[model samples]
Target: MSCFEVVDPLFGAYVLGNAPVKQIATGFDWVEGPVWFGDAGCLLFSDIPNNRILRWSPSAGISIFREPSNFANGNTRDKQGRLLTCEHGTRRVTRTELDGSVTVIADGYGGRRLNSPNDVVVKSDGSIWFSDPHYGIMTDYEGFRAEQELPCHVYRVDPSGEIKAVLTDFAGPNGLAFSPDETRLYVADTGRMFGSDPQHIRVFDVALGGRLSGGEVFCTISPGCADGFRVDSEGNLWSSAADGVHCIAPDGHLMGKILVPELVSNLCFGGRAKHQLFIAATTSIYGITLNRRGAQTP
Candidate 1:
């Protein structure tokens, strides 16, 4: 059977008929983040509940990259090729240097401790942006249960190490990414854990000095919320859904779906040509080659 559900004809041109979804890794307690390292020829993802990060490559299969990872959730590489991670246990965002030393990026704001940094992405301007949600500290399963010190907000860390809360209106600001040209920003609001709030993604027009305007609902995910997503070169948003992955056009319309047996949490494009979509589902990691390329910064 076909693994794709086409909603719009444009999606048909982005998918390949022979490229099937392949489960490359499994046996995790809840995978959340998946980042591709083309230079290293490997993919790294977080097993949130397991408190570890695993690396997978075609030649080496699966290997433990970091243990006791402090319940890391989302990850992305900076312009310098260093790893930026959101740690639930520490409730901070950290950067892994080329020499393997970890640097704390942000832990608090306005003299209060941050709830927990969930997902992260770095811009081409050397600034780091991430979502701060309370999901990490709500339960002992994913992280240590603790009091929330600050309101959930999305943050931007300038290249000079100045941390600023770019957006503060979200109840649960989860996964986020920038458009190919960095002119727009897309963020997902999953709502409070188990709350009745709507689950949808929002888009903002990023202006000079990182000013944002035009906060509007871009699209809403069905069957599941938008946990994480990535934009392609053509500005198509591929978001994680309960049933599978949903492809949303720039016009806020569903284009297609990539069906997976597991609930997808996050995904990123990898491979030598940036055509492979590596997915982080509930307990497994899957990958599939696509006809399009990811627009994320390396």
Candidate 2:
């Protein structure tokens, strides 16, 4: 049986008919933040509730990348090929240096502690962007139960170590990614604690100096909320959904869906060709080879 649901003729060109969704790993409490290190020929992802980051390779299989990972959620690579991570337990964002030392990127702002850094992405200009949501601190499941010191907002950190709240209106900001050209930003508002608020993704015009304008609803995901996503070279967004991965065009229309058996939380393009979709679902990791390439920064 085909694992895809074709909604538009354009999406048919993006997927392979014979490429099946393969289960790469299993037996995890929850998984998110799948990032590919093509140079290393490995994929690193967060087993959030397990409080560790796991690494997978085509030849060696799975291994522990980092235990007691501060309940890390989302992850991405910087322009310098350093590992950038959002940690819920630490309520901060961090970068793993090439020398194997962990550097604290962002924790508190304006003398107040951040709620919890949930998802993160690095811009081509060397600026780091992440989302602060209360999900990690709401209970002891993911991180320690503590008082939220800051509102749920998206922040950006410059190369000079300056942190600024770029967007502050989200009840809960989950996943985020930059357009291929870096002229637009897409952010997911999954509502406060995944509650009654609308589950939709918003797009904004990124101006010079990172000034944002024109934040309008880009697309609303159905059967689930948008958790994390990555954009392709054509600016089409492949977002996580309840049933599987939903492909949304730049014009804010649903193009198609890649049906999976589990609830997907996040995804990234991997493989030597950057055409493989690595997915972090509820309790396992899955991958599928696609005909398109991802626009994610190395």
Candidate 3:
């Protein structure tokens, strides 16, 4: 095991430095999707098989934020600081209001139900974006096995409540993140439910009107799949993979790796200063302090 080090200055040589894979908490059955609630001073993550959302904090440790979560997967916060979530069981994107009420955002497109909303993100302008794949519907473990009513596609929900398909024809879209400037989008193509030959992250330029254009390959992972990811203020991409967490530079180059004991599912930045990286791995949750804070939330 390696000792954890705090790499200061975002561009330092040790930014992607390895550290001991300390297991903060365990006993989760298939953990996925994580987001920091700085205002609440807690970290929220999904326990898919348990159908609940778990909360962790420096003081509270672990607690149940919500039960019967409808197999929520990915989570993020909107510009108004509301919690946006993708629920696989319900095949819908929902927003949790400050008063604790859940509002359904989008569950259908073009008169058909979504396959299964996998991961989600909120743009600075208050639009919601998410990936729809059938992983949840095809399995009885993560969520209820249901027949998919629509093809898998990445969808965008405008601020005006209009839902539209942004990208089609991906094998299996897993996770996505926006560039620091919100001018680019990075989406992970996990591909065909564990099939070979198409597991990579694709980058798309966000047009002036927020439409995606100039789709192109961003970078490919080696011996692992890029599941979910986030970007830093310096434009570096931090993503989860089968092996661990891989940090990629803005120029689409591999920089370093943070080895965890399990296949990482998702991660987010938190802490009093928002410099701590909290990861929800397959079976446990781990965290490390970084010298620099993450980029401002989008």
Number of clashes in every candidate structure?
A: 0, 0, 0
Best by lDDT: 2
lDDT of 2 by residue, 151-268 (tens): 9999999999999999999999999999999999999999987379888999999987889998899999998989999999889999999999999999999999999999999999
lDDT of 3 by residue, 1-298 (tens): 5433223333455443553455777899888888998888989999999999999888979999999999999998988888888998898999999899999999898888898898998888788899998899997888888887887899988889999889997989889999988999999988876567588999999976678897688998765878888887778888887777877888788776777778888888887877778888988999887665777993
RMSD in angstroms, all models?
0.7, 0.8, 2.5
TM-score of each: 0.99, 0.99, 0.94
lDDT of 1 by residue, 21-44 (tens): 999999987998899998999999
The alpha-carbon deviation from the true structure for residue 36 of candidate 1, after best TM-score superposition, in angstroms, is 0.5
Off by over 4 Å in 3: 3-21
- Residue 55, model 1: Cα distance from true site in angstroms: 0.4
Error of 2 at 195 (Å): 2.6
Poorest lDDT segment (10 consecutive residues) of candidate 3: 2-11
Whole-model lDDT per candidate: 0.93, 0.94, 0.84
How much is the lDDT of residue 233 in candidate 2? Answer: 87
- Stretches off by above 4 angstroms in model 2 are none
In model 2, what is the error at residue 191, expressed in angstroms? 0.7
Model 1, TM vs. native: 0.99
